[model samples]
Target: MKKSIYAAMLSGIVCPGSGQIWLGKKLLGWGFISVSVVCILVIMDQIISRAQVIAEQILAGNIGNDLTSIYAAVSNVALDASNSTMPALTWIFIVNWGLSVASAFWFGAQQDKQLQLQADSKTEA
Candidate 1:
């Protein structure tokens, strides 16, 4: 059980679904991995778009054509990007990854316990 848990946790480090795979839960692991990948890609796209918008704004002189305005605009972009994608997606990834590892461990442990109980019952019988 410990070995399974360790493997699952290790897999999570590589990708969210990896740990689930280690525990023989291929479908669950794949689901988690797919969701994580999609969320990450979406986050990246949003960040890139925000950066491009900021750049265009700078180029267009809409930010006062001054260093201070440029700095402020950059900061605003950073904040917006963080709010738009980073925080929410990061939380989702973390939760899914954690759940995958925890589920793998719990499943393995429960199976082991059940087998042990069955063996004890047979011995007693």
Candidate 2:
């Protein structure tokens, strides 16, 4: 019982779909991994590129270029990007993360039930 909860929590909170993988749900786990990879790569690349641009803006002394200014600029840019493919990417990320977490917990439950059924069958036999 404790192990099941721990595994589910770990999968949901830490790796998302890892619990499913632990339960031998390889297809779901790998699907999660692939989708997550794409979303994460896009988000990380965006962050790094934006950070570099912010740094350059600071170097160029644009609009005082303080942390607050940088934040505002980032928000504005993200908002602008929302009108493009950025929102789609962001939604993909959101949906994938949510699915991963849900899959982890759900697969954990399914695995536990499967084990219970097998144990009962063996006992009856």
Residue pairs of candidate 1 with colliding backbone atoms: none
- In candidate 2, what are the lDDT values of residues 1-125, reduced to their tens digit? 63367656766677766766777778888787788788889878877887788778778988465778878877776666444555677898778877777767776777778888999999999
Judge candidate 1 at residue 80 and give its lDDT. 62
Query: Which of the numbered candidates is closest to the native, going by highest TM-score?
Result: 2
Give the TM-scores of the predictions, in the order they appear. Answer: 0.70, 0.72
Q: Given candidate 1, what's the lDDT at residue 16?
A: 75
lDDT of each prediction vs. the true structure? 0.77, 0.74
- True-vs-predicted CA distance for residue 31, candidate 1, Å: 0.5
Off by over 4 Å in 2: 2-7, 65-72, 81-83
Cα lDDT, model 2, residue 45: 86
Model 2 lDDT, residue 19, Cα:
66
In candidate 1, which residue ranges exceed 4 Å CA deviation?
A: 63-71, 81-86, 111-125
